[model samples]
Target: MKDREDILRQIEELQKKFLEILANNPGIVVVNSDQTGQVKETHSTRTLAPEGEKDVVVEIENASATTHAVTVLPTIYLDGRQHPKVYVHLGEATGALPKFKPVYSNPNLVIGASKSHIMNKEGTERFLKEVLFIQPMPKHMLLLIDSWPLFLNHSFIQQFVPQGHKVTILNIPKGGTSLSQPLDLNYNQQWKSVMRRLNDAILIHEIDYKIHVRDNLLRAISQVYWCFGAPRFCEFRRYGWYKGGYLDTHPAPFVTPPKYLFGEGSEGDCTCGEPGLILCPYCEKPHCFICFVANSHRCA
Candidate 1:
């Protein structure tokens, strides 16, 4: 086994290499795409009620009867200028995948529900051709990714590298994903949180209409589209290099600083000046778009 000092040295070297790549490529477009699975509506937690009033428990009846999962592949660019793309995986039961809904034309959504919900070779190729390829980006682009088998496929590399789309697999040290992977460190949690809120909204709507939301592929598709199509969702793609200390601004080098490291004062109130432009589903607190972005849309 390696000694503690030796392991630390190796980690430092790995980070140094990563930073070197970033420093060398100033304007390179960094792309990251990841898969997230969402199941049909789940049981809501039981809540307390006032005295003499019984607690009403909302449970998903026959929860296992109509099992469904949505595999979402969200592609984000480092620069906030480019619009993000999100693809939804539909299982085999949903025959003949539908074209993306008209409203979400810019983000370019695709549907594939055959054999598996997870991204496959075909889906990957389609995404490259339809989403990434068509983007009006620079000649040289870097795709930051984890060690996913599909991403490392020989055919995939052969098809893209010659065209100047380079893929770099992050060498994630043990327990280092939060520090190395952009999607893990910055995007996925925010995406999932938005997904949860969307799911909850759908469930509540179903309850109001006395409709069963389970096994409803259309509902699932709607939720996926709404969440992914949201402008805030696309804006959530922050680069990990800046957050992980692999890249830094002026007056800082080598040393990684804590969040809000510079003596920047606390964030001021939302620019909108409207405290309750939108009400949070969980907390029932009103928040403007600025507040939502600053707080990651979580209940305070």
Candidate 2:
């Protein structure tokens, strides 16, 4: 493991290199985007548990586990322009559908639902076309992102590059997202904090009226979009390649253990955990071959 000082030095070096690249490429701009998942689980600042209990459990009535995937695009151009967009894509779980029709009519705030509660290829393509591509912009745009397959899709890139717009995809260094990616630096926490407050407000309103409906989720999400307009979204774009302060800050350490550990000469072990090793792309942790095969090679 690298020491704190070493990590900080690396971050500074990377930040300088990123800025130099931007300076060399005058027309290119950086737009950082990422997605986060939110469930129907209720979170409150006030606890109802007894004084001695360490855990506070609040029973929610008429509420199922409905997941919603929110994709936030905090665009920060090299020229320091501030126009960000937020997309709330809900999943198609029972009672998870949006009750309010036309959740958001504005182009900046897009709210919709999907069957898997995650952004599919079609949804990603639509976002790039409708929200990103349609916006008035220069000829060259560089989108800095993590290694999400949705962004690296060949067909999507091929389709978008030919429309008089030059789109360049810059994948952040593996395991270096915390230092390189603008959205992960501090914006995601702010967005989630705002969402949690909105959720708590809705929970209180629903309990007061005794109207425990799934629409509460939709209403809360709608209000979040309304509140997190361009100005609020721009606040998240504070950290990026242009900001030298981000490089000076030290990042917190994180480590993930292997999904499955195997003893030497264990039974039913093929290649003794040497061959067919499947690792998580994000964390780079080795997974048990059997578990990976059974679960369709998905990383938890």
Candidate 3:
């Protein structure tokens, strides 16, 4: 539990202070960061096995669903690494609309696409070395990892973790990850539910959207993932940390997805004369769900 870790940390601090006083030594700086990431087997696989937790709040995990799992990724291999021209060429279509934008597109995220799509041993190490540590982190690091077989190799993970740092990795007990890890406590389910809502929107509206297409799939997932950035879900995330023992005090009560997003707020009529329940935040335009989704209505 975070409370327990805090006590233990305080004890260590006290010991260090006492020893410093006796030896006349100075104090040291500690760099702290917490985050999460996911290791997916395929593009459309909802099968989620969380990779690790960087800290208590930031989550690096996948949303559950398989609607786009078959977007095949071809493997490229070379010995002594061929020149850049050795790579297959693509026209502007590859860079066209519907890019797979993540919640954060810059240094905050390090992404890799693989043929298998799973973060196997090599991929996990790359995530640690490249994506997870995109920037120089603090000297003292604590990582919360599930008891997945790949993470069992301390040396392999250490190979990617930066040098000159004290990293403490604690693996959740087997079968305990579902409860011990903050990311799983409710994060994954909420994420899946959001995607399901989008799926429902797509189906019920009978829109001719090609969301199952690879590019469209990426775009849709990005849109759904982006929804969590709203204040309601962002505040609800703290509850997961508290449940996972990362937070000592209970977080202030906040609105959840169902209560906020799913609840029937003030009823009104769409501009098309249809009865509407959802209002676009940007335009305050009341829109029937079908109009909002099918027409892709938004502020001009």
Candidate 4:
């Protein structure tokens, strides 16, 4: 594992490399956007430190270092002028980005899961079926992915978050607690460290964070779903976590929704299905609540 010095040095190197890139292209500009989506543009100037500068950079750097874990910070480079900017780091890799974005189009729904893995997959699929297919896509989406991105398959992410929506995936590494509430799952060994392993995978990838992958996940999902008029996409949180850092416990059996909303035009029954009901997508699957079973480690 790279030590703190190595990480800082690497960051300095990247800055120097960026400086060189800037030198070659005089028109280069660095744009910084705050959480409000307000844009601020700045020009780069080369000035070696004057004879006696406080050199406060070291102190600021030290204070910022504590905000580890990816998905929090977002470094954007919008060369000169561009509408769509690319993320310079993966979601969780940057610890400064806010936990959620400002825009929430649709009414937020919470689907809790008994198991983290089950929550991951099931939440994704149900979002695809009910939310994406049924309702209009939001202008913006803020997603929280627990642990690492392992449970997610890129292809599926591409299918959701269709155009018209800009989704951000925030990762909460293992050993982190939700800003909202304590998760129902106990951290004891009885659960066999499943959540721990999942969290570790996230931390490993975040060591030297890269934004290309996160941008791809966001843009890919946006293009297919938005540009192509495909169904709207769902953001995965490795489990069911809503915006504002709210942690959802697995829903009780009676309240949980079904796996497939419309299975080949046949019925996908939930506990609430009425006897002799139409047995159709509209009747049985009332909402997009993924049964926690789908995200279980056993199924994964």
By lDDT, who's the top model here?
2
* Better candidate number, 2 or 3, judged by lDDT: 2
Per-residue lDDT value at 293 in model 1: 30
Task: In angstroms, give how far residue 26 of model 4 lies from its true place.
Answer: 29
lDDT per residue for candidate 3 within 1-300, as digits (tens), equals 886666556544533443344244223221111222321222223323336633223232344443234211111111101011110111122332235553223222233444433345544655566544434454644455566777667777776766676555556555555555565676556655654555554444444554544445444443333334344454466666567555567767776553444445524778888776455533545676556544544343
Off by over 4 Å in 1: 1-14, 46-54, 63-67, 94-107, 160-176, 204-236, 239-241, 247-300
User: For each candidate, what TM-score against the reference?
Assistant: 0.61, 0.60, 0.55, 0.22
Better of 1 and 3 by lDDT: 1
Candidate 1 backbone collisions, by pair? 90-113
Q: Write the per-residue lDDT of candidate 1 for residues 163-276, one digit (tens) a residue.
A: 555545444454445566666765566555544443444354342321123224434343333434343333333444456554453222321111111112222333456433
Report the CA-based lDDT of candidate 1 relative to the real structure.
0.49
Better of 1 and 3 by TM-score: 1
Model 3, runs deviating above 4 Å: 1-67, 70-111, 163-165, 264-300
- Cα-based lDDT at residue 262, candidate 1: 12
**Model 2 clash pairs?**
91-117
Task: Put the candidates in lDDT order, highest first.
Answer: 2, 1, 3, 4
